[model samples]
Target: MKAMRLEAIGKLFVREVEKPVPGSEDLLVRVEACGICGTDRHLLHGEFPSTPPVTLGHEFCGIVEVVGEAVKGFKPGMRITGDPNISCGLCPQCQAGRVNLCANLKAIGISRDGGFADYVIVPQKQAFDIPLTLPPEHGAFCEPLACCLHCIDMARIKAGSSVIVLGGGVIGLLTVQLARLAGATTVILSTRQESKRRLAEELGATASFDPSEDDPIGGLAGLKGLLPGGADVVIECAGVRETVMQAPKLAKSGGTVVILGVLAQGEKVEIEPFDILFRELRLIGSFINPHTHRRAADLVASGKINVEKLISRKITLDEAPETIRNPARAGEIKVLVMAGT
Candidate 1:
């Protein structure tokens, strides 16, 4: 089996490795497609906490090459995606249905071997059969779409509500569509990528702003007049500190601010205590998903979410390293690493 090993910070290489076997409750999946995430870069730079000598790729899907004993509803040939956030069902957070915050959580790409390889193991409970009707490449998007779904769930956007998405990366674009589906009447997108903004407009955004050239918060006044108060929710999907700090300011008084992006570990952004008190804003943080992955898979499989337009490039496993190294490659947004591409 060929696996891309992250032996240490600032290093990765493809190596021939022994294939893995599954436990009685596990399934061995042959990798088909994996999405390279920004966190992968963070892991490579030691900006995030990850055990060294690990293979890094969590957003992936594949066909079941072999099923361990007692793994039901799955056969050797079944195509599937799964919840990568492995949790101890006995933990307090897990018992409370907040498995994303479980004390004993072990993620596939972070803590164990992930899908950037020929074969990877997953617990049967976390694995879901990909709807056969959809293409395998789209199935690869299941995990990321699920993560965005979890973020949208945190906002609780009301119908006709005003919403803003900070950032136009893969997650930001996905968040725009979900905000529209939640019945938001006004969707404002802030991003520097002109190409991404155009795509966002085609999807559902009422207007797109280039935050690099102009102030995004300047438009909030008009958005406030459009809404009953202002934007009912602001979703910070950009992991940068500037965007994180701007989220609450973009919202109107009493509006909710959902911090959905994964900031680098130990990173901090300054915020005044008086601002929270004066605005009476709700500052909520959305971490990894809880249990919305299946719903996300269904949403994408059913064609309600138009993410195909968000995919800007497709490559094989051999191209993964270069893709990770150069993010500005010709309007790249959600580059799909299809098997044998």
Candidate 2:
């Protein structure tokens, strides 16, 4: 078997490795496709914490080649998507049903070996079965879409409400569609990239804006703007300091703001406490996918979410190391790593 190993921080290489075996409660999954996420770049750049000497891919899906003796409801040949976050069931947060906040969270790709290889061992509890009929790449999107679903749940969008999604990346684009499906009548997307802005509109954004050209908040939330008096909900998906700072200002006084972006550690932004107090706005920070992977798989399988259009390109595992090391190409949405390509 072959795997892309991160030998150390700032280093990655493709090398031959032994095929991983399933544990008592695990499944040996043959890697089909894995998406190259921003977190991979962050880990490589030391912007995010990750255990080195491990395979680096979390958003993955594949066919089960071997099932463990203790595993149930899963069999060889079944297609599944693994929720990489493995939480200790005995942790305080897990006991309270807040698994994402588990103190002993060990993500597969971040802490141990992952799906950026010929095989990955997935615990039965972390795997969600999906229809085998869908495209292989579609299954890899379950993880990201699951995270976006959590953000939508926190946003609490309502019928006829207004939504403004910051950034036009895959997360922003997916959030736009979910917001629309959640009953937000007026959905707006802000980004400097023209291609992304255009793509946002096609993906359910009622309107798109170029933040570089004008003030996104004022242009859309001002008294004379699109959704006068601000939007009912503002979701920041850009993960940039500017967008995080602008999120609150883009929301209506009593509206909500959800931070779905992943900012680098120790990053800081200036926000007005007085405004939040006076307006009574609800500001929330959304973390990784928690209890939403199943729903994400259902949505993708049902063809409700347009995962196909978001796939920018697919590359072989041999090309994955370079792809993860370099910055994403302009306007590229998602780059998938195809195992057998």
Candidate 3:
């Protein structure tokens, strides 16, 4: 089997490795497609915490080749999406139903061998079934969509509510659709790329803004801006310093700001505590997909979310190391690594 191994920080390569076997409760998944995430780049640059000498792909979907004896309700030839985050059931956070914040958490691709290979092992508890009739590439979206679902849940969007999504990447674009589905009437997206801005509007953003061209904080949240008094909810999805800092200011006095982006581990950004205090704003940080993977799979299977448009490129595993090494191409949304390609 072949895998893209992160030998160490700043070291990544396509290496031939022995195939993995499933445990009593695990399934051996033949990697079909895995999406390259910003976190992959972060992991490569040591901007994020990850176990080196491991495969680096978390957003993945595949076909079941071998099922463990202890696994039930799943069989060979089934298509499924894997939830990478595994929380210790005995942890305080898990007992309180806050699994994402569990004291002991190990994620696939980050801590273990992942889907950027010919085969990856997934525990029965981590796999969600998706229809075989759907395009394999779309299955790769389930993981990211699940994370976005958590962000939407945190945003608490309501009917007629206004939302401002910072960054027009896959996360931001998916969020725009989810916000609309969540009953937000005014959905806006802000990004520097003109192509992404246009795509965001096509994907249900009521409007899009280019921060590089105009001041986003003023153009979108100003008194005379798009949303007169600011948006009801502002989601920072760019995972950059500027967008993170602008999130709170883009919200109305009583609006909510959800940080759904993943900045570098030690990256710092200054925010105004007094402003939050005065406005009574709700500022939150949304982590990875906690309990939303199943719903994300269902949404993808049902064809409600347009995962197709979000796919910018599809490449072979051989191309993955370089793709993860370099920055995303101009206006690129999501790139998937097709195993058999």
Candidate 4:
């Protein structure tokens, strides 16, 4: 087996290693495809929760090369994707069904070996079986879409409401489509990249803006002459402090703001208390996927979310290191690691 491990901060190594053996409660997946995520970048730079000298690929899917004795309903050739957050199920938060807030939780790639190798092992509890006929690459999207689905679930989006998604990355694009399906009458995407903005428009955003080129908030006001009534819901997916602060400003009175982006540790932003006191806005912080991983697989299988457009680059495992260093390598949007290909 060839594995890509993060030896330490700012370093990754692809080396030969022995394939793992599946335990009774585990399944050994033959890696087919994996997606390089923002978390991976953060982990590489020591910004996220990952121990040094670990195998560091997470967003992925593969064929079940072997299944443990206790793992049933899955065969040697089953295709699946799931990396359940390992948590104390008996903890207060887990008992309250808020397992994302569990006192002790460790993610698969961040806590242990992940899918950036020829084979990876995971508990059957975290694994969701996908139809073997589904392309492995599509299976790779299941995890990310699952996380986005969790956020969408938190939003409780109303039909015909307006939504402004601030960011045009993979998560932002998914948020746009999900908001549209939730019945948002007008979906707006704010991004500085022309290509991303164009793609958002093509996907479903009624409008797109380049903030680097102009004031997005002001532009909308210019058209409507009334600040466009702000958005009924402002979902900040950019994960930057400035954009997070702007979420409140972009949201209308009595509206909700869902923070979906990951911020750095010790990061802070300023928000006026008067605005919250007078306008009555709801602020929510969304975490990782909990029970929605399977639902994400269903959505992808049903062809509800178009992940194909977001996939801009697909490379093999050997190129993972360079791809990790350069975000735009090969014009990457969602750069995938095709392990077996």
Candidate 5:
């Protein structure tokens, strides 16, 4: 089997490896398609915590080639998407139903071997069944869409409310659709990339802005601006210091701000505590997907979210190492690695 392995910090390579066997409660998934995420780049640079010498793909979906004897409600040839984040059921957070914050959490791609190869071992609990009828690449979106769902849940978007998505990446674009579905009448997206901004508008953003061309905060949040005040909710999906810092400022007083982006570890941004205190704003940091994977799968299967348009490119496993080692190409939305390619 060919696998893209992260040998260490700043080192990633495609190497031939022995095929893996599933555990009693696991399923051996023949990798169909796996999306190259920003976290993969972060992992390569040690920006995110990940165990090296492991396969480096988390956003994956595939056909089950072999099912463990202990696994139920699933069979060989069934299509599935792996949740990746494995939480210890006995952890305090898990007991409290906050599984994403589990004290003992091991993600498949980050810790164990993952789906960047011919086969990946997925525990039964971490696998969600999706329709075999959908395109193989659609399944790979479940993980990221699940994370965006969590952010929407936290945003609590209401009918006729306004939302500002602070990035035009896949997360931001998916979020724009979700915000509209959540009943936000006015949805705006801000990104420096003109192409992404245009795509965002097509994907249901009421409007899109290029932050590089104008002052995003003032242009959208000022008294004479789009909202005439500020958005009811501001979700930061750019995962950069500038966007994170601008999130709260873009929100109306007493509104909410959700940070759905993954900033590198040890990164810092200076925010005004006084503004938050005075406005009584709710600032939240949304981590990985919790109980939303199934809903994401359902959304994808139902064809409600436009996963097809978000796919920028599909490459073979041989091309993954170089792709992950470098930054995402300008205006690239999502890149998938096709196992059989």
Candidate 6:
């Protein structure tokens, strides 16, 4: 099997490797499609924590080529999406139903071998079944969509609520649609790329603005601004220091701010403590997908979330190493690696 192995920070390559074997309670999923995430680049650049000498692809979906004897309710030939974040059930956080904060959290792609290959092992518990009738590429979106669902749950968007989504990347675009579906009447997207701003508007953002052209705080929330007093909820998806620092300022006095972005480890940004205390704003951090993969798969299978339009391009596994090493292309959304291609 051909797999892209991350030998170490700043080193990655496509090498011929032995196929993975499934454990008693695992399923050997034949790689169909896997999306290249920003974390992949971070892992390559040592900006994110990841175990080297492993395959690095977490946002993956595939057909079950082989099912372990102990696995039940899942059979060979079934299509499924793998929830990469694996938590130790005995951990204190896991026992408290906070699996995302598990002390022994072991993500498939980050901590162990993951999809980006001909075959990858998926523990039965972490696999969510998706429709075999749907496009193979669409299944790769389940992981990202699940994460966004977590953000939406934290945001608690209500009917007629106003939203501001920072960044227009894949996560930002997906969030825009979810915010709208959650009954947010006004969903705004801010990005530096003009093309992404346009795409965001098409994806249900009530309005889209380029934050690079001017100061977002003054441009969007200034007197006689787009949202008079700021948005009811501000979701930061860019993972940039500027966006993270500006999130609270973009929120209304008592609004909610959710950090859905993955900033580099040890990164720091200046934020005003006085403003948060004075306004009584709620600032929350949303981590990996927890108990939302099934919902994400259902939404994709039922054609609720528009995953088709978010796909920017498709490449073969041989090209994945380079893709992960380089920064995302301008105005690009999701890039998928089609193993079959």
Worst 10 residues of 5 by lDDT: 216-225
Give the per-residue lDDT digits (tens) of candidate 4, residues 1-341.
89999989999889898899999989999889999988888888887877778787788888888889999788888888866477779889999998888888877778788988888998888898888778778888888787788887887788888888998888899899988988888888988888898899899999888777756667767864534678888888878898998888888899889999887756899999899778999888889888888888998887888888999888888998888876664324688999655
Stretches > 4 Å off in candidate 4: 224-227, 329-331
Each candidate structure's count of clashing pairs:
0, 0, 0, 0, 0, 0
| List of clashing residue pairs for candidate 5 | none
- Candidate 3 per-residue lDDT, tens place, 202-314, comes to 88999887777766556555633577678899999999998999899889999999999999998899999999999999999999999999999999999999999999999
Give residue 328's error in model 3 in angstroms.
Answer: 0.6
User: Over all chains combined, what TM-score does candidate 1 have?
Assistant: 0.95
**Candidate 1 error regions (>4 Å):** 217-229, 328-330
Model 3, C-alpha of 79: deviation from truth (Å)? 0.7
- Give the CA lDDT, 0 to 100, for residue 105 in model 3: 94
Q: What is the per-residue lDDT of model 2 for residues 217-262, given as tens digits with 9 covering 90 to 100?
A: 6655553359777889999998899999989988889999999988
TM-score of each: 0.95, 0.97, 0.98, 0.95, 0.98, 0.97
Off by over 4 Å in 3: 220-225
User: Which run of 10 residues does model 4 get worst, by summed lDDT?
Assistant: 324-333
Clash pairs for candidate 4 = none
lDDT of candidate 6 over 122-141, digit per residue (tens): 99999999888999999999
Where model 5 places Cα greater than 4 Å from the true spot, the runs are: 221-225
Backbone clashes in model 1, listed as residue pairs: none
RMSD of 1: 1.9
Candidate 2: minimum summed lDDT over ten consecutive residues — where?
A: 216-225
